[model samples]
Target: MIPSLKNILIVCLLLAALPACKPKTAGPLPPQIDYGQDTCDACGMVIDQPRFAAATLLVNGEYLKFDDVGEMLAYHMNHPEAQVAAWFVHDYLSEEWILGETTKFVKSPTIQTPMAGGIVAFADQAQAEAFAAERNGKLFTLDEMRAQVHMVEHP
Candidate 1:
């Protein structure tokens, strides 16, 4: 009915080792974004748009959510040391989450995005082309986002 000293010590050691039990570098963690209540991990602005949301899984197994993909980019640009495990963005057309690096992007002043970045993502080049054609926008690859991100105003 009573616990022994040896049992207590064992339990304490197990509790302390629990942190070490987490998987390391086996795979990237999934990104989590809370629609309205979540603040942009980069600029501390509330993420209100379901259309322009972005999030990334850091190498440390932490998630950084953003109101705009531009905010996410600005953070990475400013903090070049950030270890990003995976990048994700919401498709402006579908509001669906997709891998950021593989997705096509368009920058248009006609499209009003959070942070005034005016950048949008699409899962396919055709989609990006169609969107850009209708809006007179320019298309870019993920690697090119770093350059367009300069258009976003930093907080």
Candidate 2:
């Protein structure tokens, strides 16, 4: 038997509302790394330090984990063809994940990161500034970090 018009309308409304019922997501999320077990995609070193850990989310939904923030930048520099969606780094103080683009970075030999990357991320600019001042490091934005990677790798 054919459905009534009222029943069909009800079904249609429910279908329309189904999408809204699902939880909203803020786009693609970074992957969780199993420290000491997970290895850096670029350097092939075990990612044991949360404060120095970094990751890149590619457009294809692949996560490239890194032992150091500088390694992540170097990966992108070498693989310029990579289609990156987002970057994630751990705040040095909190060891919490933060968007790399919006985060501030400090670079210095004194930082003592894995693979001698010497770069650390911070969610707060003030905190980064303080860290840089204490370590005699230079503050860098994401773009500047990319350029700095070249120098580190080449030199």
Candidate 3:
């Protein structure tokens, strides 16, 4: 026998009230990173080896990372059109690192720029550009950036 109209309505209401059978989100959004070895996927250079990776990890609100700063410099040097970018670093403090999963892949990187006619290193992009624009200087080339690294800083 067919169920009564009240029962059908109740069943419909219950189904409606229940959470839609939508699939649960799988996990945290995947970071735009290459957890691979310390190498720039774009240029195939060892990351963070020659220089610390410095790039805009958040570009237009999107997560990003460079394998290292050298690569970021190289990329911008090669392509001056990049508006913003990101870089990845190993997370020694993460629990995942303890589990052997490694938190080295990047979700985003802090943005920075070169400074002082390539003489000084500024911690922010605006400073670098201001110095460059005001002084009639240009951004450091990848070679220049590499050459400026002090042995004390790396060692």
Candidate 4:
């Protein structure tokens, strides 16, 4: 039997709404920070330096901005139970947001970060190595930075 016109329109409308019912997937990119206006979620300091900015994306889609990479590490370390969807950091040279897991890190006392964290991120390993060598800094991976922060907090 053929459906009535009203029933056919209802079916068409339901089909049109189906896509909107699908679960929304979060994007892999990090959220933009309002530099000089956005305050760090950890230290409450203004995030004026794009090169030194860091952020954590929670599973709930909350973006926690930080003034320094070390501050981001420390925040996560303290909130060990927080569900983190992703971590992001700005490339020291380009000031572009990069996946923290794929970025290289350098830590040195003389690096002079915003919060004196002395941590900077690089999108290129060779560049990170060169920066480390030039400033007597040590190279680290994302896990190493987290571990370093954990040690400092726990000890």
Cα lDDT of model 4 by residue, 1-155, tens digit:
98999999999999999999999975687888988899988778899989999999899888899998988888787887777999999999999999999999999999998877899999999999999999999999998888776422422
Give the alpha carbon lDDT tens digit for every residue of 1-81 in model 1: 899999999999999999999877744444666777889877788898877998888888778888987788888888777
lDDT for residue 54 in candidate 1, whole number 0-100: 88
Better of 1 and 4 by TM-score: 4
Please give the lDDT score at residue 137 for candidate 2: 98
TM-score of each: 0.76, 0.82, 0.31, 0.79
Give RMSD to native, each candidate. 8.4, 3.3, 12.5, 5.2
* lDDT of every model, 2 decimals: 0.83, 0.89, 0.39, 0.89
Better of 3 and 4 by lDDT: 4
Stretches of model 3 off by over 4 angstroms after superposition: 18-21, 24-28, 31-38, 46-65, 69-92, 95-155
Q: What tens-digit string does per-residue lDDT give for candidate 3 at 21-103?
A: 77787333324333445455344544442223333433565543444444444455554455443333322222111110121
Q: In candidate 2, what are the lDDT values of residues 24-47, reduced to their tens digit?
A: 888668789999899888767789
lDDT of 4: 0.89
Superposed by TM-score, candidate 1 places the C-alpha of residue 99 at a distance from the truth, in angstroms, of 0.3
